[model samples]
Each structure stands twice: as structure tokens, then as C-alpha cells.
Target: MLRYVTVSKNSLHDITLVALIHDIKFNLIKLLQ
Candidate 1:
């Protein structure tokens, strides 16, 4: 149960990081345009 919780937390962190990176990329593209 602890392991599962850790894995879920890691997955959530990765997803948040990906979302942040995507947002930065989108903003950069908008700025370029």
C-alpha cells in the first residue's frame, strides 16, 4: 500500500511537471508570433 501511494505521487509529480513545461512552450510560441 505504501509503495502504491509512492508510485501515484510520483506519477502526479511527473504529470504536473509536464504540464508546466507545456505551458512554458506555449507561452514561448505565442511570444514569438
Candidate 2:
């Protein structure tokens, strides 16, 4: 059960990181345009 909790946490962190990177890229593209 504890392992499952940690795995979920890691996945959540990865999702957030990807989302942040995506947002940054989008903002940069808008700025360039």
C-alpha cells in the first residue's frame, strides 16, 4: 500500500512537470509570434 502511494506521487510529479514545460513552451511561442 505504501509503495502504491509513492508511485502515485511520482506520477503526479511527472505530470505536473510536463504541464509546466508545456505551458512554458506555449508562452514562448506566443511571445515569438
Candidate 3:
């Protein structure tokens, strides 16, 4: 699909990726507590 290709083109932007990873890490830490 075009959307898939487009996202691949930009890799969802560095800022978006950072935020996503950060959110995941936060959730994981929260779970540990």
C-alpha cells in the first residue's frame, strides 16, 4: 500500500520514533513497579 511505502520513506520521522520508543519504555517501567 502507498501508506506503507510512505512511512518507510521517512521511517516515521526520528521524533515520532523516539516518542514511540519512549512511551514503550515508560509503560515497561510502570509495569515493573
Candidate 4:
């Protein structure tokens, strides 16, 4: 159970990081245009 919780938390963190990166890239592209 503890391992599962830890894995889920890690996955959430990674997802959030990816989302943030994607948002930044999108904003940059818009600025360039």
C-alpha cells in the first residue's frame, strides 16, 4: 500500500512538471508569432 501511494505521488509530480513545460512552450510559441 505504501509503495502504491509513493508511485502515485511520483507520477503526479511528473505529470505536473510536464504540464508546466508544455504551457511554457505554448506561451513561447505564441510570443514568437
Global local distance difference test of model 1: 1.00
What pairs collide in candidate 2? Answer: none
**What is the alpha-carbon RMSD of candidate 1 to the true structure?**
0.2
Weakest 10 consecutive residues, lDDT, candidate 2? 1-10
Checking candidate 1 for backbone clashes, the offending pairs are none
TM-score attained by model 2: 0.99
TM-score for candidate 3, residues paired by index = 0.62
Off by over 4 Å in 4: none
lDDT (0 to 1) per candidate: 1.00, 1.00, 0.89, 1.00
Model 3 Cα displacement at 18 (Å)?
0.1
Question: What would the per-residue lDDT of candidate 4 be over residues 1-33, giving only the tens digit for each residue?
Answer: 999999999999999999999999999999999
The alpha-carbon lDDT assigned to residue 13 of candidate 2 equals 100
The TM-score values for the models, in the order shown, are 0.98, 0.99, 0.62, 0.96
Q: What are the per-model numbers of colliding residue pairs?
A: 0, 0, 0, 0
| Candidate 2 lDDT by residue in tens digits, 1-33 | 999999999999999999999999999999999
Residue-wise C-alpha lDDT for candidate 1, range 1-33, written one tens digit per residue? 999999999999999999999999999999999
